[model samples]
Target: MTAYVGKRLAQAVLVLWAAYTLSFVLLSALPGDSVHNRIANPEAQISPEEAKVMLAYYGLDRPLAEQYLHALGGVFRGEFGYSLSSGDSVGHLITSALPSTLQLTGLGLVFGVLFAGVVAVLINYGRWRWLRSLVTAVPSLFASVPTFVVGIVALQYLSFRLRLIPSVDDGTVRALIAPAATLGLVVAAPLAQVLATSMRATRRQPFVHVLQAKGAGEGYIFRQDVLRNSSLPVLTLLGLAVGELIAGSVVTESVYARAGIGQLTVSAVNTQDLPVVQGVVLLSTAAYVVVNLVVDLVYPLVDPRILVEGRSRRSARWRTDGQAVESAADLPAGSARRLPAEVAMP
Candidate 1:
């Protein structure tokens, strides 16, 4: 387990580095420097020498390789550098915006998992065929809909038409409902699909049959056996869903006009703020890596067989050797008894 954790941590560092490198390359390839983006108005133009000085100030005049090395070093030192557009520390901007994104992500993940689990249970365990089919199809329907579309629909119906929630940003929990639900439903769709499929497969396993033969109720069997067995794959899918959640947040935040990493991302992209963009990408990659690391750590606990099966195999090998030795010793005197293959081999 310790070795596994260390390996995962090492891999996570590599992932973060890769994300930084890729973002740096892509952002650097874009036409025009931060100076042009910052100085948007042609009417308020500066001299060519002044533009050169500005580019030099931001170290943009350096070779790409040098800039990349500097950026890599800065990341390791927890210095994300200054935002080209705002002249504020990229780290500071990210920190300021992180809380809202975290809140939305947490809430959306919780709600999505709950919603998916409920829908999966109803669809799989319920008796009505029509209802089951309908519920099963709902996830596919939701999955087909984009997050932006869902957000807009929710805003129109829930906020504007029904007036159930605030029409615009109020920075209140009530204001979070539409955006959270939009993100949650998008996350929930694939989760529900995978979970329902896993549950169906688990139900067909021999243990489930044994439980039924023991006169266990369906609910008890499902709760104790089916759900637990089915959860491993679902947990894996949930870990993978973190990326989807982050991607969806961009659209949801834009629609809701919420202040978050998503909104910060949009602003950075529009202004070609390379440092801020790199910072956000690095942060997002870290979040994904951490979440998957947690899932890896939790996996053995959920399925003890993962840990025990290796030990059992080693013990079985030892027992086989002992049995071969015993069989060799018990050979009849002068009876020409052939030794077992295992004992004769060595």
Candidate 2:
């Protein structure tokens, strides 16, 4: 078990290193220097010497390879670079924006799970076949609508037109609803579909049929067999849905003008803020990788078969403290055989 975890942890480190390297390469390829763009305002008339000093201050004056090595080393040492655009540490910027995005995704996932689970369970009840089909169709509509469009529509109708909530602020939680709901809808749709299909499949399995024939109550079968068997697929879909939630909310955040990581990413890209862009991209990618790793680790807990498989490949050893006894009566003086005399006697 320890060896398996060590291997997975090593693999996770390699994956994160590769992702960070990839982010650096992609950001490096973007046109223009980070400091150049920031100080290029015609009205400001920034001099060449000042620009050079700013570039040097952010390490942009160094070769790309050197800068990358430094950045990678800094990451390992718990240091993030200074932002060329904001003159603030990249770490600080990410820390400031991290909470809102976490709150949004976390709450959105909760709502999505509850919505999906309840709808799926109720819909799959055989008595409501027509209603089940109709409810199942709700996910299709959600899948069809783009997240950005949902954000716009939500803000327009729910916030602006209906006056249900206020329209713009970075400080309060009220500003989170429109964007979170927009993203939640997309996540809920597929989760519901997957859960409903899994539940139906579980209901048809032989164990469930056997339980039904043996006079077991529907609730008993559902609790003991159906839901248990259905959880693997549902959990797998949840991981994928979480990825979709993050990706979808990028646009939703922009549309709602929220100061989350997504909005920060967009601003970083538009202005070609390399440090800020790399910082945000690395932070978001780290989040994605961590979420996936957590999901991977959780799968075995949900299914003991996985734990068995993980252990079966390894060699097991046992130690004994005393000489072997040939017969129950002939056993060593201090050791008593637990087996019956008829069985242990030779």
**Candidate 1: worst 10 consecutive residues by lDDT?**
316-325
Instruction: Tell me the tens digit of each residue's lDDT in model 2 across 1-346.
Output: 5665677678778878888899899878877865776678777688999888887888888999999999999998878888777778889988998888888888788878888888788778847678877787777887788877777777888777998767775566677766677778878888888888899888888878888889999988888878878888777777677668777768877787777888888777777878788777677667766776677777777776776655532322221245444444555467544533332323
Number of the top lDDT candidate: 1
- lDDT by residue (1-346, candidate 1, tens digit) is 6766787889988888888899899988999756776555577687778888878878888999999999899888989899898889999999999999988888999889988998999889878999898898889888888888888888888988898888767889998877887889877988898889999999999988998998999999988888888899888988899999999898889998899999999998888788888899999899999999899889889997765654443333222323432343454455444434443322
TM-score of each: 0.87, 0.84
lDDT of each: 0.84, 0.76
lDDT, residue 58, model 2: 84
Badly placed stretches (over 4 Å) of model 1 are: 37-41, 309-346
